[model samples]
Target: MNTTDALEAFALTWTGDLTYDVAPSLSCHEVDTLATLLRALGYTAAADAWITKHSRNDDEGDAHYVTPAAALREQLADASDRTPWVELREEEPDAFAAGHMVLHAGGRNRFAITEQCDRPSDDPDRT
Candidate 1:
């Protein structure tokens, strides 16, 4: 399924429960799509944490079997309220503002966001 469909399916079915044991099982692609959607909705930290837990190798076993960190759970809970999931469903992904972060999954499933350098340079020497 496309990312939007995946996202809508997740949002519609999610029970708002942060308990890992109760968390819904998702395919690797679904996990990637959810993480990408979360990042698009500006919940980068939660997305990163969720992806980190779920993207382990098969030998490592599924991390979803364990409870998520309290902070991660809190982040997810907060994000659920703040994210415009319904509105996003109605809009195309391309409609996101320029430089918005998008998650890309690859070998080993590392998380990366395109940096939007709107703030002044951090290096004092540069100024």
Candidate 2:
């Protein structure tokens, strides 16, 4: 299939998120749609609802597997580099402050759901 077809297929299975206020002052927020993509790409565990005859285990993959498109991954990664989702600072100051920014710098997601962060090379000692 073409890139649009691949992205469309991937989008159809998007899981969105899960929300709960587990604490009085803090809420452990999580996004499950990304979770599904992560799982398929051999990252996170797929949701329990994915019980399929072919999947080795429900936690292993979704009801269907999606093969990522290299072109799409490249395009999304390029776009992310230009304007990172990692930079929602003012509008999402709390999220911006929670910096695990380095992780986004490098990863393999042939699918477009996740993109490798294109951070500039680091020189350890800044101070």
Candidate 3:
């Protein structure tokens, strides 16, 4: 299969697997790659949706924590049933993440979940 087909097949494999909570935290590079691949595959809507989902807020500043809203959180929690290896990481300040739900999935580090917020509670209380 060609690159585009391969990507589509791969994406299809993770159909139900793609969700807010179980999503992966993508770096700037990963986002670019994903967007490019999606567009190349003619999945423009999907690409746009993915980017919009992961986009960060303009006023979020350089560093901040993000979390999903109630409805999305509920969906994510449900999605975790199939993909149990999901993780929610507080990304370091970077070019991506417009204060959205940063997810790490399919062994990839770049993917965004929508309905996010900037709040101190969004971070892990490791301290």
Candidate 4:
């Protein structure tokens, strides 16, 4: 699929109900292709996060899983890089602030993005 098509497919898979599971089973090549497309579309942070979360290091001699949030944090914390997730911050403020970006995995090799709540969890009115 083309970059726009891939992005559209990714967005179409988004879910708002956090209680419901959202995982897209994709191959390693698919993951790499998707990340590359995202980077081409100016989603550098998301692309890097995807790569970091999915990359397997043979040198380590064992597979290690990194959470999407952790990967995103690492990318955003890099001082040498330009501002990351500018479009995401403007488009999805709650998710951006909560460190919940597109393409997150609840388990190894499965990934999806969910809509985040804007309200504080401590608020009794929030459901």
The per-model lDDT (C-alpha) reads 0.45, 0.34, 0.50, 0.44
lDDT tens readout by residue for model 3, 80-109:
544767655434246344445555564555
* Superior by TM-score: candidate 3 or candidate 4: 3
Q: At residue 55, what lDDT does model 3 achieve?
A: 43
Q: Order candidates by TM-score, high to low.
A: 3, 1, 4, 2
Stretches of candidate 2 off by over 4 Å are 1-68, 87-127
> Compared with the true structure, what per-residue lDDT tens digits does model 1 show for residues 92-116?
2544443333332333332223333
The alpha-carbon deviation from the true structure for residue 40 of candidate 3, after best TM-score superposition, in angstroms, is 0.2
Q: How well does candidate 2 match the true structure, expressed as C-alpha RMSD? A: 16.9
Model 2: lDDT to the true structure: 0.34
Error of 4 at 65 (Å): 9.7
lDDT by residue (71-114, candidate 2, tens digit) is: 34433444555665432111223333322222233333211133
TM-score of each: 0.30, 0.16, 0.36, 0.30
**Candidate 4's residue-wise lDDT over 1-127, tens digit each?**
9977876666444312211221124445665676676666666656654555454321233233444444454444442134332222212343334434433222232222443545777876543
Per-candidate clashes come to: 0, 3, 15, 0
Query: Which whole-number lDDT from 0 to 100 does residue 66 have in model 3?
Result: 37
